[model samples]
Target chain A: MSVITREEVAHLARLSRLALADEELDHFAAQLDQIVGAVARVAEVATADIPPSSHALPLENVFRPDEVRPSLTPDQALSGAPAVEDDRFRVPRILGEEA
Target chain B: MSLIHESAAELGRLMAAGEVSAVEVAQAHLDRIAEVEPKVHAFLHVDPEAVLVQARAVDERRAAGEELGPLAGVPIAHKDVFTTVDMPTTAGSKILEGWRPPYDATVTRRLREAGLVILGKTNLDEFAMGSSTENSAYGPTHNPWDLSRIPGGSSGGASASVAAYQAPLSTGTDTGGSIRQPAAVTGIVGMKPTYGGSSRYGLIAFASSLDTPGPFARTVLDAALLHEAFSGHDPMDSTSIAKPVPPVVEAARQADVAGLRVGVVKEFGGEGYQPGVLARFREAVDLLESLGAKVVEVSCPSFEYALPAYYLIAPSECSSNLARFDAMRYGLRVGDDGTRSAEEVMALTRAAGFGPEVKRRIMLGTYALSSGYYDAYYGSAQKVRTLIARDFDAAFHQVDVLVSPTTPTTAFPIGERADDPMAMYLADLCTIPSNLAGNAAISVPCGLADEDGLPVGLQIMAPVLGDDRCYRVGAAVEKAFESRWGGPLLKEAPAL
Candidate 1:
């Protein structure tokens, strides 16, 4: 059985917000199947007792005083926005068709 | 006697002594970039006027008797992936094209504070995902030695800028082998600081766990100096190491490995390895033994699984980290016509803005993290990661440092493996183990391979927080090789 099928790739593209074309779906399905096949060998590495490492190094939460410090001004903050309106980022409507 | 060929150390010294001015040094490099960039294509952006403004400021500070950093007036290249408030901070993708960042990356701010002239941003694989720069939405950066070949990526331009002598120092982010592999192919020096050793604040994320900002230079000592000036505890980065930076500069100057134990990784050599690359790596090991270092072959069986594990782990992190690029806030956005909803716009924007490789990773990561298959894919890969780290722990117990061929082969011709993702991934086979373990590793030019007559790299790795060890061993190998070749290996590269 193939690791990933064409329909699954389309499903993944939707989940990933990619909107891949018909050709991309076909090409990627084939390639991803091969990649997943090769990488699946890791599933066979059964060190049942060993723990999984979520990070390269152990991490901890950082704490800071509840005080404000100087940071980027609103103009600087909005400088790179694709679209801005009234000191805020402009965007398309949020509600989908059902709403 | 142009100033472009002078090392960063030499340039800084001359600028400090008042024997030379920063503008003069910057102009020489800018002139060289103009001359060679047409062929090398090492920089994605260069503004001579802005470059001069920074250079002139350095000279003014010196005139005021201000004590500047060691590399205060030296010119350096900034990788485009780092957010630079003054220049476009594209991660080699159209999504971020023409996007001037609101803040500088910690690395960029450090470079500016140190008075290093920012010539411009260098190119990389889009989001630092690929082994070669062909994935760059902008055109690929060509190898200086052989224009027909790649310069090792996603720091390809970072390595090429220094190799082509356009700049003596450049910054790079190593997610896998981006820095070391490029340095190996270009006949230069590159170092990946232990994860969390360098601040990543303002760096555009790519596999946040594995992405590490490091240095690329023509010499080991120069790399260490740059490493120190920027690396230390950063309150902004929760993961940044709170401990003092390692004594890398001191180690580079030590340049002696007498009585030090060196382990040659047994798994890195053999079938699928190029014969000439193996031969050069063998010579480097023998040279270490001749210098009174105790040499032994060490086996790390888990390293065999590093590639697949890294492919899954990196893509998984990338998928999560890159979610910020939705069409709502910053960067490229498309199909925002009022009739369409935000979700539709986001899908259209991502599809139009991202290159194929980035898209591939995003999808792969989505699949890996999705339900049902999560345990079989992402879960298994995490387990493999633990095993890889354990192998490093065991090897470090027996050896002070580990060594291997930086890459499987020399720089292959451009477009040779472009269509085959697996073939391209093989280029980073020897370098991924260190990234997985978050250990300090450095790659320095060993010698040219006989087959392709291209430069080969000797990779030296040390334990976490033991970054200085890699530089110590690297400096020793560099000194001996320079003495044997009568100069650095880059001196043998054909003129552009």
Candidate 2:
């Protein structure tokens, strides 16, 4: 089993969407190396013939009836909001790219 | 009243008879919280007033001579991950700290309908990521058995509260070993009903496929009653099993090991496990044999790969599941002067909101799912998952149940393995496969580890939807060992 490296850790952080500090990077790097080393054993025995599984049971088209039902009013929905504006639950602009 | 220590069944009987008020039961738990919470650190948020209000409503209903479910008037706390309208569902993470959900999770709703008094929300590892409660951003919950040692998590606080007598029953969600491991350390009964047995409508996601919500309590029957209340389909969760929850309380009382076939997984019972754990486990198996259960060695050869496969699959899903925490949604927001972009705001919020363990998982998950690596990492991990499931399927045909040590050893000292992530990950080795297979499992206090005198749990697992069987076998074995020991293990633990 190979140890995880700093670049791999950095790449993972980018994928995860969090910016880590310089101090936290080295600590996580070593930690990840150990964890990955332990978990890497699966690759040895996982053969090509086996189809990967995601869920234990197969479920198909499990949807609820689409009917309007009483839901929390907008005020109730936004009751826990730290900030709001124009009766809408205010959030920072979610889609950062100009649309 | 001292009935705070009474079983959920006893409380229900008292409430139905109008001999003890629901409010009285709720108040006793609230008082217990005030008395023991400092040392146990079990609750994240508790509303004494709200608990009393809910209790009084149950009392009023009973005073009017209305029908009630088995858990009515029984006080219970939920793990912080389960959403509750009356309190913030933090999931022990700063990302959603102080955020109250718009609606209660279906499990929480079911408990409310059953008139189970809502005591509070308990602590857990942030995002339920770690085996030990040490990963909790709030603070590690001290095992009631030995205050300096960790209460195994991510359901640490749930088990701790019950063990500490802060509440008689609590809810816990196990992904890997969260529920069972904590139960082992705290000397309580925790059962992860078959995956999808309990609805996940409002439980903040943590590896969605593996997550299971279950019950924690002082006895098998108590856990069975609370589990019965929540184990059924909810329109909100597609994965929820459509089957009605089997009568677990009846199973617990009628539990018999006579002629039962139990498989001792060869992969689990071996070295790397502490000697004390081995000794206690051997004795537990012997006791099972004495009770007339046919115990034999069985191997799920693929389990050797379970830990690795789980790490990959769990992180991949967690990365996707946790994306909802971007500051733009409903939680803490930071950064962004209008001149700066929203992207910057999300970065800052996430960085500030999440702790090290959460960040590590998100990063690892993201890496596993990234385009170039997806086929190599997540894809291969999923394949391993298939093999693990097949292994379980093969083993079950030969045995009615599988048994193993809940953890490699008993509770470890705080900070002992926190810095060593691999050692910490190994803590869930025996517990991870059940989640992968969606099997029902329970960890009941079997005996104390000979070395530390700390508790060792005997984990019993059964086929999916065979939840009542776990209780039947577990209750029988628990009685066999508990009777010999004279009482529950925690009763003998040095007072905190």
Candidate 3:
């Protein structure tokens, strides 16, 4: 069985928001399939009992006093924005036609 | 004075003693960059005026009697991945081509506070996803050793800057051998400090858990000095460890491996390793024994799967981390001419912006983490992470540190592995295990490979906070090899 098919790669591209070209779809399908086949070997050694390790160090929620501190000015915050209006980031419409 | 050739420590001392002004030292390096940058293409951005400005400030501070750090007046190259408020901070991705960040990364801030002159931002593999810098959207940085070969990467430019004498020191981040592999092929010292030992506050994330900023220098003590300057806890990054920076500089100065138990990873060498790389690695191990260190071979069976597990884990994290570049905020936005929706523009921009390798990994992570295959791919890879850590724990129980060839081969021809992802991935084989376990590892130039006449590196790995052990062992190897060869291995590099 193929690890990932061409159609599946197209679906993944959509899910990942990458508008790949037709040739890129074909190229990536073959490469991703090969990589998947090689990397799937981890399952062989990962017995059911072994707990997964998401990160190497322990992660904990940190807290600080609610006092405010100095921060980037509005000009600095929006400096890198592609578009800005009213000192905020501007983006294309987010809603659907119905909304 | 040969300012460009002097180590960071020497540069600092000379400036402190008023023997050399920071501007003069900076000018020498700027001149060197002008002479070499055209051939090597190590830097993504270099403003000679800006460097001299920073250098002059350092000189003035010293004149005012401020007690600056040991590396106070040294010139250092910053990796492009770190955000710099004053300069364009593109992570070698066209998506961020001309973007200027609003604030500095903690590493960048620390470098400035320490008075290290910012030489410029160096090139890297785009979003730090590739083993060789060929994936850099700008262009590949050619190796100084051979213009036809890769300099090793994602931190290729960092290693090459020091290797080519463009800069005495540079900074790099190692997620999976980005620092060590490049340093290995380039004949320099690169250390990946323990995962949280260095701050990740404003480092553009690749794999948040794995990305670690570290120092690259021509000598072990120089690397140690840079390491201590930028490392320690940062509250901004929750993952940052709250502890004193390890005594790595002192360990490098100590340079003793007497009675230390060194373990040669049994699974790393042979079969797939290049003959010359393996030969130099063995000689370094033997030299360690000769220096009064006890050497033994230890088995880490799970290490065989580190590369595969790493492929899955890093990409999975990258998929999440890179999601922040959705074409809405800072960076190259496209297709938003009122007709297309934000979603369409994001898709169009990402496709137009990311290189083939970055796109491939994002899609691979999407596939790995998708509903049906999650257990088989990403989940299993996480399990293997535990197994690999267990392997390290077992080995550490028997040895003070582990040693291996930093990589499987020397600098390969640039185009050789560009089309072959697996072949390119093999370049990071031996250095990935340490990343997976969140341990400290350093790559010090051992010698040149006989076959290709290119540099090779011996990797030294220690447990989580035992960052000092890597410096101790690396410094010993550096001292021994320097004496045996009558100079550093980099001295053997053909002059550009």
Candidate 4:
């Protein structure tokens, strides 16, 4: 069976918030299937007895003092924003339907 | 010899002695870039005025009788993935095409503090995703050895800049073999420090768990100098190691391997490996033995699964790390025709902004981490990751360091493997296990392959916090080989 179908790829695109084109969907479906098939080998040796490693280091609860530190000014913080309004990021309507 | 052709250490010495000014060193490199960049395409951006300004500052500091760092007044080509306040940090992606970062990466800030003059930002794979710079949205960087071939990537520009003599030192980040593979093909030294040895704050993320910033230079000593200058504990990076940085510079200077035990990885040779690359690596091992080092064969059985494990784990982490690039914040945003919703605009912007390889990984990551599939894909991959780390742990107990050919082959012609993701990924086959295990690894140019006459790298792997061992062995190999080749391997590169 194909590891990934075109419909599944489109669903993944939507989940990833990427509006992939129709051609891209077909092409990616084929490539992703092959890659997924190859990587499936990982499951072959990942027995339940073996513990998973989320990170290379065994770090935990890294903390810093709760004191305030100097930070970017509002202007500096929003300098690279695609759109800004009143010292805040401006985006298209979030809740409203398209006009 | 031209100032541009001098090593970083040599340039620094000359500058400190007042024989050559920092401005002269910077200008010489700028002139070299101007002459060769059209063909090499090593740099994505160069501001001569800004470069000279920094160089002039260094000269003034020296004239005022202030003591400076060992690398004071030397010029460096910074990989574009590191955030730089003065220059655009593109990560070779169009999404952040002209985004001027408000902060410098810890590596960038430390280099500047060490008094190294920044020449400019060099090119890289988009977000350091692919094995070749072919994935760069800005266009690929050509290898200085053969313009038609790739300078192994995602750190291709950093390696190529040093190889071409446009800059004596450069910074690169290795998530897999991004730094070493490129350094191998371009005939330079690249070191991937033990994870957490260098801070990653302000570095554009790829796979946060696996990403590590490192150094590239023509000599082991120079690479070690840069490595020391930018490494150490940083509160800014939560994962940064709290211990003092290993004495790599001293180790490089020692350049002796007498009585040290070296292990040749049993799995890295034979089938699928190029005969010429294997031949060169074997010779390097022989040289180590002749230098009084004890050599043995060690097998890390789980290493065979490194590639598949790395592919899953990197993309799984990248899927989360790259989520910050949504259209609303900073970077390219499209499809907001005053009528579309924010969500629609974001989707359109992302679809247009990312390259094919980046999109493929994002989708794959999403699929792997999605509901009902996470356990089978991502969870299993993490288990294999544990096994890989255990393999390293077990091997380190028996050997001081493990050796292998850095990559499977020398530089392949550009565009040969562009459409084949698996083929491109194969370039990093020997270097991935270290990243998965967070061990220190260095790739030093061993010799030119017999078949193609291109450079092949001998990889030296050391245990965590044992980064100096790699340098000690590397410098010994470098000294021995330079004696045979008459000079650095890059000297043989065709003149631009």
Candidate 5:
């Protein structure tokens, strides 16, 4: 199997949204290559027509009754929050806003 | 009470009779931990003061003539994957380092109700993703037997702690053999309860469908005592079985193998297994026959593909289950340059939060589940899963239980498979099929490998929900074998 190429690592990093240090990229490339190569063996038999089985048990519709039950209060939910403001978890804005 | 090595049932008897105070039992384990932990590295955290507090509470309740739980005053460590209300549960990942859950997992709540004192969270693979505990963002834990070797993984820390006698009992979760493999390498007893037998409401998800929480201890009956305390129905987990918990403890005590139909899998006893492991497994099978149990060879043909299919399906579910760790809700976040797109920040946060192995799984999962690849990848893997299950059903019809080498080999040096990912994944071949089939399995130390003198695990597996059978037959086999070996394998483990 081909080793994970630098371009492939860069693409995967982009997909994973990781900002890899220049020094670490080479090491990760080798590790990712080995892992992907090992896992990629699934392709040999994973042909079309077989429905994927995500769960081992065959049971379906594992839903709880939609009864309104107790829930963690905002304080409890956010108790371990690193940053919070106005009863909401605070985070950097996703879409850039007007300064 | 200094005989903390006594089975949990024995300890409970003494505690109930007021022969030993819970505080004294807890203190002895605390002192034992102090002497052993630096060498074992089994624990990520140890709160002796908190342990004492819980033990004292158990003592007070017993003093007041109140009903106490079975494991009262027993000290146990939990794998970091189980969320605890009082202790920080990081799931052995840096992303959630020092993050404490607002509520305890069902297993933790059950442990508390049983009056067991929580020693602290033990180490594990990061997010329980890898086979060896080496993948933990925290430093790797060394095996107690050979300080330079591994104690097997994901539940490595829990197994190591028990093997090193830092704690008498501990809790571990198995997904792809985490509990069993670790116990095998560490020379302790570990079991994966039937799927949904133990609630997974609070276990951090790696592969949600496969994760099953169970117990690890020094002896079969101790594992039985711990399992009795933890296994039950939980409203919080949809998959939690509402049926009465099986009588595993009683079965262990019965320890009857007479007339028990034991099936030895044809596929598992083949090439790639260490010679010592093969010999030990053969001896175990022979012992069962001598004890009046009929041993027959059975075949699960589709199991050969189980490891490959599991790799795909586990990662696919993992990719989806772990998507919640995006920087927005919980866990760490990283951002540079105050101005950035929401999408950009999400990416940066994920990149920073996930370790290499986690990212690798996520990427592979994402790739598998991607629209075009789903049919070819995840789809076929699932069909193979059905085939694997069918193969198991066919075998179960012919035998009451199956046996194999828990792992292909005993413990190797820490870095042996670090760079060889395929080799690492192969270590779990014998154990993976049990998880894929959602059956109950246990790994008890059969003997030490002749070559390295490292521990080797003899695995016992049963049909889905055939948990009691595994314990029943396992206890009998262990009794017969340990007598010849002189004692439990871990008892000879070097004092750390």
Candidate 6:
């Protein structure tokens, strides 16, 4: 069986929020299938008894004292925004019909 | 020798002794960059005036009798992936083109605090996804050894900067083998300190679990100097280790492997490895034995699965990490001419912004992380990660450090593997397990490959916090090889 079908790649692109072209969908489907097939070997040793390691180091919740520190000013925070209005990020319509 | 060609340590010593001013050192490197950058394309941005201002400040501080760090006056190139307030931090992607970060990456902040002059930001693969740097939306950085070949990436520009004498020191991040592979091909020293040894607070994320910032330099001691300067506990980074940074500088200066047990990984050699690379690696191992170090061949069977597991896990993490690049916030925004919804704009922007490899990985990650398929792909890859770490744990029990060829071959030509993703990934074949296990590893040039006349790297791997061991062994092998070759391996590189 194909590891990833063209339709599945399209679905993945949607979930990934990428508007891939039709040809990209075809090309990536073939490539992702080969890649996915090769990486499938991980399942051979991934038995139920073996535990998964999410990170290399054991981490703990790092807490800081409830104190205000120097932070980016509104100008600095919005400096890189593609569109800014009133010191806030301006985006297109989020719900309902397009504006 | 040209001032630009001197090591960071030598330059700093000269500056401290008043033999050369920080401005002079910075100008020498800037002049070299001007002469060679058109051919190497190593830097994405260079502002000579800004750099000289920093250098002048260092000179003034020294004149005022202010105590300076050991590397106070050295010039360094930072990989563009590290955000910089002064320079546009593109991370080699058009999506972030011209985006000047409001704050500096911890590495950048620390380098500045240490009085190192920031020459400019070097190029890299887009979001650090590819091996050859062809994935860089800007352009590929040509290897200094041969302009037609790659410098090995995604830290290609970092290695090339040091290799081409544009900078004596540079910083690079290794997720897969970005640092080590680039350093190997460019004939320099690159060390990936233990994961979390350095802060990643402002580094543009690729695979957070595997991302490690490190140093690149012309020599082991210089690499250690840069490593120590930027590494330590940072409360801002939740994963930052709470302990003090390992004493790599002292270890590099010690440069002794006497009585140390060195294990040669059995799986790293044989099929698919270039004969010349193996030849140099064997000679390095032999030299270690001659230096009073005992050498033994150790097996790590699970290593064969590291590449596959890495491909899955890295992309899976990247999918989640890269989601922040929505057109709503920073970076490139497209197709939002008041006709599309927020979702449509985000989709259009991502598709237009990301390079092919970046998109490919994102899709691959989304597929792996999607429900129903997550268990077989991402979950299994995590399990294999544990196995790989266990392999390292087992190997460390028998040896002080493990040694192997850094990559399967020397630098291939620029376009040889660009079209082939799997072929490109093989460049990290020997370096990935160390990242997966979050161990400290360093790549030092051993010798030139007999066939290609390109540099081959001998990788030194140590336990998690045993970063110093890597420097010790790397320095020993580097000294031994320099003596045998009559100078540094980079001396043999053809002049650009």
Evaluate candidate 2 and give its CAPRI docking class based on DockQ.
medium
lDDT accuracy of residue B238 in candidate 5? 84
- Regarding lDDT, does 1 or 2 come out ahead? 1
Give TM per candidate: 0.99, 0.97, 0.99, 0.99, 0.95, 0.99
lDDT of 2 by residue, B1-496 (tens): 3776677888888878778888888888898899889988998998898889999999888878888887888899889999998888899988888898999999999988988888899999999999888888789898888899999999999999999888889999999989999998888899988888889899999999999999998899889988888779887898988878877878999879999999999998667899999888888899889999999999899898888888988988998999888776488887756665666777778999998888888877787787877877788888888898898899999999999988898999999988777778888989999988888999998878878989888899999888999899889987887788787677787765
Candidate 6 residue-wise lDDT, A19-97, digit = tens: 9999998899988998998999999999999999999878778899999999999999999999999889999999985
| DockQ metric, candidate 3 | 0.85
Q: What DockQ, on C-alphas, does every prediction get?
A: 0.82, 0.62, 0.85, 0.85, 0.50, 0.88
Model 6: chain B TM-score relative to the native chain B = 0.99
**Candidate 1, B181-285: lDDT as tens digits:** 999999999999999999999889998889899999999999999999889999989899999999999999999999999999999999988999999999999
**Per-residue lDDT of candidate 5, residues B270-329 (tens digit):** 688889989888988899899999899998877788887788788888888887877666
Model 1, backbone clash pairs (residues 3+ apart or across chains), number: 0
The better-scoring model by DockQ among 3 and 6 is 6
What DockQ does candidate 6 have relative to the true complex?
0.88
Instruction: Tell me the deviation in Å of residue A37 in model 5.
Output: 4.4
Docking class of 3: high
Candidate 3's displacement at residue B442, Å, is: 0.4
Per candidate, the number of residue pairs that clash is: 0, 0, 0, 0, 3, 0
Question: In model 4, which residue pairs have backbone atoms overlapping below 3 Å?
Answer: none
Off by over 4 Å in 2: A1-4, A89-99
For candidate 6, lDDT tens digit of each residue in B356-415? 999989988988888898999999999999999999999999999999999999999999
> Model 3, B77-172: lDDT tens per residue?
999999998889999999999899999999999999999999999999999988779999999999999999999999999989999998999999
- The Cα error of candidate 5 at residue B345, in Å, is 3.2
- Which candidate model has the greater lDDT, 2 or 6? 6
Clashing pairs in 3: none
lDDT of 4 by residue, B293-326 (tens): 9999999999989999899989888888888989
Q: How many angstroms is residue B390 displaced in model 5 relative to the true structure, after the best TM-score fit?
A: 0.7
